[model samples]
Every structure is written in C-alpha cells, then in structure tokens.
Target: MGPTGTGKSDLGVALARELDGEVVNADSMQFYRGMDIGTAKLAPEERGGVAHHLLDVLEVTEEASVALYQEQARAAIDAVLARGRVPILVGGSGLYVRAALDRLEFPGTDPRARAEIEEDLARRGRSALLAELREVDPESAERVADDRRLVRALEVHRITGRPFTSFMPRREYVRPAVQIGLGGPRGALNERLARRVDRMVERGLPEEVARLDAVGLRRGRTASRALGYRQFLEVLDGLSTVEAAAEATTTATRRLAKRQVTWFSADPRVEWTDFREPPEEQLRRALRRIAEAG
Candidate 1:
C-alpha cells in the first residue's frame, strides 16, 4: 500500500494478474457508490478482468466502521483463498488495511454509554475530556490529537476498563500474508499529489460531487469529510471557488499522504519499495517476498 498517486492501484492490479489474485479495496472512500471520479476509482475495464471485492458496497450516506470492514474483508479474503486465488488488499487507508490483516480486536460499542460520553464531550469540550483521557489512557490520549478520537478513547476506557491503545494493531498478521509498502520522498509525493488533484478536477470531480449530493453524500459523516469531495462540495455551495477548492484539496491530500506514510512506516514487517522503482521490478520483489514469507 502507498500514498495516493503513488501508483499502488496499478501495482496491485499488476501483481494480482501475475499471482492469480483478486483485489480487495482497503480505501475507505472507494466503499461508496458514485464516488468514483473523486476517489480515483478504477473503472471496471481498468481492472484487467481481475475480480475486485469491497468496492461500491456502501451508500454515501452510511458511516463506515472499521470493525464491520474487518469482518467483510476477512470473509472476502477467505473466499478468494478458497478459490485458490490470492487476495491483494490495496489502499492508502492504514487503519483499514491493519484491521483486515492484523489480529486486532474492536471494543463493543455501548450506545447508552456512548450517548452519555458524547453529551459530556459536547458540554465539557475536548480539553476536559483530554485531561481525563490522560488520567486513564495516557498513551492513546497523547497519540490521538482529535476530539472525536479522544472521546472514543475515553469512552472505550470507561466501558472496558482498559487502555484505548490496547486495541491498537500489532505487527503480526492474522493470516499468512505479505505487506508491501511504496515509499517516495516527501517533496516528490507533494508534487505528485498536487498534480493528481488537478487531474481529479479536470476529470469532473465537481460533477461527481453534484451527482452524489442527490444520494445524500452530505449526510454521510465519513463520506462528507473525504479529502477532495468536501472541498468541492463547498465549491458547489458557492462557499469556495474551483481554484480555492483545488488548492485546499491538494494541501489536505499532502497531509493525508504524510499521515499514511507515518502510519505504515511504524510496521517493521512491511517490505518497502521506492516509488521510483520500475513496476516489473517491484512486482518481482513482492513475489519474492511472498515466497520467502511462505
């Protein structure tokens, strides 16, 4: 897996073709229908006859849960393995990728407890909750900078009496698998991401967002906040210009790429290849790594 525009999708398809594998999408945004252009979703014809799973499975209005995704993706992987085809999990969503492959357990949600915590969060604000989290799960509180995540950590701690980081992914994979990471320098990735954003707008990202608006994309907590879509939605609402939106999208995407890099880099087991490497070489390296891993 790699940052956006780092050519992970192309590599995934190439590797799948070589290994007789089906592709499993781990990108969160690609889960929605009609989010194609904005998400840079590969067209069916572009998939090279390699069956792809877990794309277009969710409505734009629905919230995406990593726990639910874990179950569905694992089942897909099992089915692919049963058919004697490898399953290539591909995406820049580090958490979803980890959820699918790592032996990570999600804490059960408590609506009543969650409602209460959310109410407290709204009233007391993040500073107060962050202070409490520091008292309980200091590690997670320190690592998680957002108010939403801080609330979840505190809620999980209150419900389970365990540190929030307890649910964090370990390096070990639950299945026999190999993780290949694509790496590039920060400056190069930023330039690539800027060009990609420009390409997305030229490819009708604004029109795609307009179409999805009828399907309740704005109501989707997760979908609405997606990188390019949100900025373009503002463009539609007359709150921003196409130029401003594209610039915002580029900036946000660069930040996202940095985060994805940091997240995947933490896993010592990942075999990384430079993004500048030839595709055929990377494919041979991935195959070799998989064989060695086996």
Candidate 2:
C-alpha cells in the first residue's frame, strides 16, 4: 500500500509469514498472465509459501475492470478469513485498494451507451470528449487524466444522470484493517526505480514483452498500457531500442510512484513507515499498528 519500488512486496511477504496471512493482490497490472518480469511479480518460491490470490487471472488481450476486481478481491479476502488466516491486501494501485477495503460503489454500465461513447470518442477525439465531460461534469473532467476514464465518466453521467464524482469512495473502511505504507525520500525512490528498470531489462523484460505481444498483448486495453510493458512494446515494434525503452520506463515509473504517493498520502488512516529504516523495524512497526487497530 505505497509507491512502486518501495519494497511493498517484500514487506507484504514478511508480514504474511509473521501473521499466517494470504495475499490478495491489488495491483491491476499483475492480474495478467505472462506479464511476470515487467510487472515485478513475485514467483511462487518468492512468496515464502504464503498463498497469493488474484495474480495471473487475466489474459493479455482482456481488459481489467475495477468493478470485477472489487468482487474478486473481496471474495478472496473472505475466503482467507474463513480459513482463519489474515488477508493481506497488497499493491500500489490506489483505486483497487480502496475498492477492496472501503465502501465504494460501482455503477452498472450500459453497453449501448458505452458503445455510443466509444464511437463518439473515436469520431470526435479526446479533446472533444473532454470538453463535453467538462460541460456535464467539471469535477470528473478535472480529475480524469486519460481517455479511458474520460469516456467512462461520460458514459456514467449518461447512464446514472449523476456526476462521476458522486460515486467516489468515502474514507470509511468496510472492515477493520491497518494499511502499512512504506516510503522513502523522493531521490532515493528515483534511484531505486532506475535500478529496478535496469534489473528488469537484465531479466529479459524485452523478451517477456515480445512473447506477450505475440499473444495479443497490444490488444489489451489495460495490460498494454502498463509502465514497462508499454515502453518495451515500442522496442518490439522497432520504434525504440531496449536501452531507450528502459530509460523511458524509468521516467514513467517515477511519475507513477509520485502519483501513488499523492493518492495514498491523502488518506489519513494509513500508518506509514520509512523504507530507510531496517526491514525488521518496519515489520515491528506494522505489527504494532495492526495490534493497536485490533
């Protein structure tokens, strides 16, 4: 529950081992199968025998839906609780984390309406769609950063006759839980991200992207847009070199980390730990927080 390259995965595994917990993944990009290297997905052995749910559930060609993810993640958490094990929800995807832990409501989509909006987007371009969204729902237009969200905001407005912001989750938790946020200085995080991208390249991120692209990776609405995967896909298309792609990936990843920090920092409930501290100290602080929450 922190920024990328912040050692969240390792901390989650450590916590799971201490608490007899199973991990329910909240990272959206890690949902796709065969996106291992670029996603920094932990291998089975690396999980320290703690079962992980919701990883490798989607094909490279399929789109990821937060509504569906909410259902799946909640079910996984319930099952883990039923088994008398702690359910550790781990990832840097802020919306997915909120959907799993908070009282967030997802409005039903209208296919016909969606199709119409998609047609409009294709015909009129993103600026036109953004302009229309601003006219109908200025808050949503101000918040939305991309085409997918812009289209969805308009579709939701047309379907529900309400502003998209109305559906945003409140800060109230759906259940008792403690969020452990691991973060460090911005310069340190930037260095970590750069090294991580270089490691991904050394571990065959380009090859992994090539294999997934052969299996329709580019067709995926969500998977194709992931940080390293997107940049490396350009490498596959001869639009960039591996070295250049790695550099671009590092930059994009740093930007994503910044956004994640901003999103999570806005929530007052999170108990943050400095990654500059020793790992055992971080774990001790997290365990103490969880105990206090109980």
Highest TM-score among the candidates is held by which one? 1
Please provide, for model 2 over 48-110, each residue's C-alpha lDDT reduced to its tens digit, 9 standing for 90 to 100: 998999999999999999999999999999999999999999999999999999999999889
- lDDT for each residue of candidate 1 in 1-294, tens digit (9 for 90 to 100): 977778888899999999999999999999999899878899999999999999999999999999999999999999999999999999999889999998999998788888888899899987888888889888997898777787788779889999989987787889778899998899988988898999989999989999998889999999999998999999989999999999999999988998898888888888998887899988888889989988
Clashing pairs in 1: none
By lDDT, the best candidate is 2
RMSD of each: 2.9, 3.4
Q: Model 2 scores what on Cα lDDT? A: 0.93
**Model 2 stretches astray by more than 4 angstroms:** 113-163
How high is each candidate's TM-score? 0.88, 0.88
Which 10-residue window in model 1 sums to the lowest lDDT? 145-154
